[model samples]
Target: MANGVMIFMALYPLRYLKTKVDRLGKADLVYLLTTSVISIAVTAAVVVTLQNGITTYLLAGVASLAVWMSTAWWVGRSRTDAPGTRER
Candidate 1:
């Protein structure tokens, strides 16, 4: 569970940063810190609620990765389709 939560903590910043960069062209440190803190709090609540075994922990990480990737893909797609946004 802890490992899963840690993975969540680590992976979110990349997506958040990417999204911010796509929209703003630069990553804000305050935004990064705030999101990281929020992610930690939410993950802690989830970990406490689940209270399961190692398999659950691993599964949590996998699930989080999937969600993050899908969200990133969606955001990227939307940006490409938006007016004035060019595809690289």
Candidate 2:
């Protein structure tokens, strides 16, 4: 699970970039990409410092996954063709 979270931390931005490709401008995307890199680095450092074993790993994984899912949903809803339209 820790390895999986590390992989996710690395690849998460690709998922974000693909999802927001149509909405974000190049500058905005670049900025977001930079931030994501910084965030991953910070998370890695924090995880190393915690050294608390599985509990910390599990919590970090869950927290990161939750943030990703919520952000995806939020960005997906921020722009729409119609208010009555349902998400596919």
Candidate 3:
């Protein structure tokens, strides 16, 4: 659960930074931080409530990786599609 939250925290920054680079304001930073913290808290709560075991843990790991990859792809697509944004 903690690991999942950490993964989300790390990936979220990348997406937030990419999406908000041009705007790059304090409000954006605050929003990103708030969302990240909330996501972590929610993930921890769910994990605690469910009390996941080894098999569930492995499944969670796979799900986390899938989410991370999908988010990365979405971010990449949005970045590339933005007006005046170059694909790198």
Candidate 4:
């Protein structure tokens, strides 16, 4: 069931991106691809861990969750940084 749901969500994005292909820059493309994989993996891992009481899956979920959030933050930070601005 989880696999089916995740698969549908993954494929649905392709349909949505069909008309937006030309509008998305390379960075946007990379961010989207990275986030999609991380989101799916993390979501499934957390769900499975909860449903099965498995510590192994819990570790996987925590690790991926950190990665998912950090990626989002990094992308957002990059987008907001100006050409001449330097954070000290």
On TM-score, the leading prediction is: 2
Q: Write the per-residue lDDT of candidate 1 for residues 6-53, one digit (tens) a residue.
A: 765766576654345544233344444454555555555556778787
In model 4, state the lDDT of residue 11.
60
Candidate 1 overall lDDT versus native:
0.54
lDDT score of model 3? 0.52
- Local distance difference test, candidate 2: 0.54
| Over 4 Å off, model 2 | 1-4, 12-50, 81-88
Structural similarity to truth (TM-score) of each candidate: 0.45, 0.47, 0.41, 0.45
Q: What's model 3's TM-score? A: 0.41
> Candidates' lDDT values, in order?
0.54, 0.54, 0.52, 0.56
lDDT of 2 at 22: 36
How badly does each model clash, as a count of residue pairs? 0, 0, 0, 0
Q: Give a tens-digit lDDT track for model 3, residues 1-88.
A: 6575577675666555545544323224445555455545554554566676765555544554555445444444455454456768
In candidate 1, which residue pairs get closer than 3 Å at backbone N, Cα or C atoms, i.e. clash?
none
Query: Candidate 3: worst 10 consecutive residues by lDDT?
Result: 21-30
